[model samples]
Target chain A: MKTRYSFGGDEHVYVEIDEEMSLEAFFIALSLRNAVAEAEIPGVTEICPANASFEVRFDPDVIAPEEIMARIRELEHKAEVSDKRLETRIIEIPVYFQDPWTHETLMRFRERHQDPTGSDLDYAARINGYDSVEAFLEAFHSQPWFVSMVGFVAGLPFLYQLVEREKQIQVPKYLRPRTDTPKLSVGIGGCFGCIYSVRGAGGYQLFGITPMPIYDPTQTVSYLKDFMVFFRPGDIVKWKPVDRAEYERIEAAVAAGTYTPRIAPVTFDLDAFNADIAGTNANLMEALNGI
Target chain B: MAFKVVKPGLSTTVQDLGRPGYFHLGIPEGGAMDRFALRVANMLVGNDEGAAGLEAVFMGPELTFDADTLVAVTGAEMPIFVDGEPREGWSAFVVKAGQTLRFGFLKAGARIYIAFGGGIATPLALGSRSTYPIGALGGIDGRAIAAGDVVPVGEATTMTERSLDRSLLVPVSAPVSLRVLTGLYWHRLTPACQARFFADEWVVAPEADRMGYRFRGGSPMEFVDREQPFGAGSDPSNIVDGCYSYGSIQVPGGQEPIVLHRDAVSGGGYFTLGAVISADMDLIGQLQPNTKVRFTEVTMEEALAARAARRDRLAKLRAALA
Candidate 1:
């Protein structure tokens, strides 16, 4: 069942539906098509979607805000009730951290106060079990993670989130602030991990890079689009690392049309997922002690 | 039939309606800044509303017509001449093959529209001829018009002299006042700041283009530096950059109003203080440097009415043409 709610003298409307429907993307797309067809506005513009919200631009002369809201509600209801399953594609990207010292520095800093006689060093040594740094780098590089690249600028692609444990990796706030960050650097910042496509003033910490070009204007749809990064709410992902040699090999295979990113099949129950979210929020609050 | 560009203006490009259905990929709807003038020029030459035309900015171009063609120049007051004869603007005239069309200084406004009976024959890129120069998409070579470039003309059905009317021409020199509606963030402004915004006049700053137009005003608008993230499922902060929407008054860092234009980005960072009503976009486009502009707030009802009136006026003109 779908429920319709109106706000701001009908300037805005939202349709809440049973979680079973999983039709948010469909509803948004339908709204856009209906706005273009039913509203006789001159140059009706549609804003790119941010998160789950998408906006359509119309000439108020042709259709009132109330009318637009009404149409959206109608479309949302129809989409919610429709018995169609949307097709989604998943993609895997391999990341490589060129500098091992960054992780080593973090590990050493975390252990310094705990063990005056280097007992923590044993723990660190246990964690670093590989014969050599090169062996560790190679071993870590084989894991694949799901990534969604969204926007493009200057032949570079921008992504949304890095998924883990059937949910997005929630990044904690930075301990110390850095003013500038480099492009293609992946880092976690405030509940999200992102890959910076270009050098700019940013907050995320530097992690690593993937051999795949973020964007290439020369290609018909660009590699970002070819990867099928189209994402919806409630998707799951995991991260995998790769070495520079393997990255180059994968790049070559992609160029030769022989490589495809590994994807994991996803299945979920909407009610159960929503319940999990509620329980997780409660737990988070309890753990934080009402901070 | 084509035209040879002798001297392209500061940032001239070919434009028509715009590209659609690609916003999910971060492409902008690149089109004419002053759509009213583009329509008028198209109407004069018996072309469809979305026919490709020239959007010459800041200055005009010196060109030589390769074939006998009926053309009209509209938008902004530029001193134009044909074969050294003083040429009247806004009206269509036949240019004989091999005749030269030269433009002098720009008297007012930033962009001028030039429409030929046969529109420019540039290949449709992403369903538009409008140039998105930043992305190198659409128009001739995905860039502004330059000297020594030859643009081909499309096939056009020649009309009889009876179809041409001098009365159909739109006056290019008239001063325009734009109507506006307060947007979602309008109330975020302090009462005193709002009062100052409405009371004082603003001038078009030197930094104005298809992407955005910055205004020189009495005082800057300040806002709390809250960490406002782009809404859900949005691009990372950087790729989704630049202006958006006509009349979208963006105050980045609580200073200088950057009014977005036709070729604005899909999403942006700055606080969108206001969006100008659709009907007033052309009026805003016609403003010249140092031109005084007052920001008058109108109710949503008034905005709708103004939009209807503007549409009705255009419909009447189209009916007259029919």
Candidate 2:
């Protein structure tokens, strides 16, 4: 596939090796470079992901819209060739599942979606291809996807993606977010799981608690590293239930500094974020000129 | 020499030019909220522009000099008295050992800048003497100035007395006008809304701070409904929560515009409607709550010209001082 993109009067042309190319990633890289190059341009800024995605900023005057689109199309092609398969790794994270009401609410939700013959646990196990619900629950304690949490001081948010029974479960938005969500809350909202790092008002559904400290200003490195986000675009994830003892072990490992966080494979292009912006800018310009 | 703080006022903190280039790690560029006043005070004290000073918020402080020290006060128009004798603003003064410096209520403006002949010597964090109140990173223990805390002053030698430019003293009673440039999401507003933005005036909101100055009274502008974009790990709904470079104006809900200042976050998720011109940031800093502000959009070229003009002015001032 071939795609042409432009932004800020800059032209970018690129080819895609496969339809699987992730536009977000491609643009990110392009934007980062452009933002850096145009630092001197008023209103132009760029953000670079030392580890995840690339970003760029530009002054509209420094580059033409068509030029940005061309760069996007060109970068998309480069991303496709270097594309890596989406992979998921499970590392056990110990969480206390605070506030019994939160668990009750999640259990009720599971029952609402489960088949009549199976318990909520059975349904969850079946979705991940477990022969027995108990076994699946046991394994869950040893492995959990590390969600990406981002926010301000003591304010962290995690993103999660799960797949089951060849059907994608869409997480809904919170009908009414609480004025203050508790810290370490396992929340499900809008097709993702989020762990609240601090006490703040939020709407995501609470599932459980993880004793892990997601944010600590005193620490040298934060809990959320560049590469360890739970979901990155196309990666598939599943939740496994773990018992209290197993959870404790993982917690100890985290505290002892014995656990090494595994990095999730890159499934999306890091360059497409800029390309998409570039492409959109070009299209807007073209439509304006009736070309 | 050291000065003991008798009263720390509303929100006083040690500040400098701010720490820069560490946004990726989620650190803020915390410095004097009012750079204009800070710079002028520093210049008067024969300190570098980036020298650490005191940022007195709202009401001013009551301090006593433990030893003889040279000092200058700038920024807001707060009455200053040495041992109960009123003094003029902008001119350098020497206080005898054990002399008390008392400040009266703020007559105008929100912040006051006070600089010593020798800058305050505080521990540097992330390469700045500015205080990041949220992270508790810089300043004296990452907290605001407290009563009884003695601040150390650097070594200094007395210089011959010279007259200061009287015209440079900004009037406290008058309103300040700020220059602005349209930002990334400026085009997202409707044509009529865009036109109204420049035509209308805004008032400084009560919720203003070092992080940003929130404006009130402008009609809300609407943009196309879109999912909130992600920023550097802060609030997904507010882009300014992440990292905001100097002069970025982030408008949340297409309503109130928050002008990011020296203590602003490194990145953010809010829709940036426009940025105040760099040269005009000082003018904006002088504006206090209830101050009427009108935003006039300028082109990128105009912004550059303004910046060049500021640089030239600074050069001239430095030459005159030399």
Candidate 3:
């Protein structure tokens, strides 16, 4: 796909890989960002990859925006996501769907929702053509989600589903923003999903809760010893639904420093995936087994 | 030597240029709101342009010095006093050992920055001393100053004079014009809303702070609505969550426009108008609640040229002081 490049001021250049949010578009953006990062262009401070787009921040005093723009255009043509030799981790993240904590929070903010009379899940299911709320939750966790960006707040990640566009779950954000969302709460708005690392104002539709800490300021967890944030752009998060008893068990384990995320390494081939999404997803899920 | 805060005043925290290159981690480029004022204050006391300084807002602090040193207060205008004698702001002055420095309620402007002869000797976090209050990781214990707090200071590094040329610095007055480059998401806004955005005079809302300056007294912004794209939220203000360029103005609910600042959040789902040019960020930084301002649209070339002019002015200010 041909990328559209636009200036974000004198210091930043924004590139839109495609207008639509497709896995192919994300791979293209991610590939270009990785290629740009490896190039080590002078004055390039940050290369931020997003959903279907990316941005580059540079010191224009050293490298003019025009120079960077020309270089980016040249790089976009050469950077390849085909047969992409990617190294990434697929992490098994345990989630408690429709937990009491999020249930109460969503109930209190019903006025700020599209359907004030129904629960967020009930409304979501009806809008998405699911037979029941249980069916919606089942479909939601049927496939893994890919981390498209890690921002909005520290350690918070925006994830998009790995399934086809028609199969993707969609929901609107709250009619008005909520003053607070609980820490570690899982939220979905439109086609994107996020995990709130801390208690703060949010506009996403609340759905579930996670037991593990995605962000630790003290870096107490061994896995987060080097960096406080757990997820990065291009990481895969496999949501595993759990009951209250299992959620409490995992929560206790996490607190005692005994919990370790189940992670698997895999290479994503963009060309192969585009050719046969079902076969590729099956392969990717197969690689995730026994890890 | 150090200074002890007798009364920390309203919203006093140490700030410098800021920490860049960490926005992807969701960390803001937290720094002085009025960056140009901080630079001038630092230059008046013979410190590096990026030296850490105190940013006092709405009110001023009363401090007792442990040793004699030179200090310059910039940005907001306030009457600085040594013991009992009055001292001038926007200029350098001497503070003797054990002498107390205080101020009256703010006469004009919203915030004032004071640069000590030697920079504030706070330990750097992520390569800066600027305070990010939300993150709780930089400046004095990663928070605001409090009574009895002894802020560490470096040695008296250089000699100092009274003030810079009056014309070299902005007077920090109200009704400032913010030059904007309307290109980031210009197509998303309806043409009528775009016309109203530039034609109206916006008043600084009372809830303004370092994160963003929310403005009132403008025609509500409306977007060119259609079937909301995937990943974008349902609201008219919604877009696929993307990078929010520092100084990008977002009007949530179409009620008021909030211009992101030095502590700007890196990304959001709102449809942004455009970024306030770097040259005029200082204008909004000094604006107080109820201050009227107009957003003037300019081309990207014009914005870059304005930045060049600002740099030339800063160079002149540095040379004259040298």
Candidate with top TM-score is 3
Off by over 4 Å in 3: A80-85, A242-258, A274-289, B159-161, B172-174
For A1-291, candidate 1 gives per-residue lDDT tens digits of 334222211122222222111233323433443444464544444534332234455445456776766665555544444433223333455676653533443334442222334322232233446555445444333222222223333323333332123333323223332334444555543333455544433433345665554443334333444432333323333345677778679768767766555644444233343446445333322322332
Q: Model 1: how far is B153 from its true place, Å? A: 1.4
Q: What is the interface RMSD, in angstroms, for predicted model 2?
A: 8.7
TM-score of structure candidate 3: 0.92
Stretches of candidate 1 off by over 4 Å are A1-48, A59-62, A71-87, A94-291, B159-178, B222-246, B319-322
- Each candidate's lDDT (Cα)? 0.56, 0.57, 0.83
Show the lowest summed lDDT stretch of 10 residues, model 1 chain B.
B231-240
Model 2 spans > 4 angstroms off: A1-23, A30-93, A99-211, A214-291, B157-163, B169-176, B225-244
Best by DockQ: 3
CA error at residue B132 for candidate 2, angstroms = 0.7
Q: Would you list the clashing residue pairs of candidate 3?
A: none
TM-score of chain A in every predicted structure? 0.49, 0.47, 0.94
Across all candidates, what is each one's fraction of true contacts kept?
A: 0.11, 0.03, 0.45
Clash count, predicted structure 3: 0
**Model 1 per-residue lDDT at B319:** 79
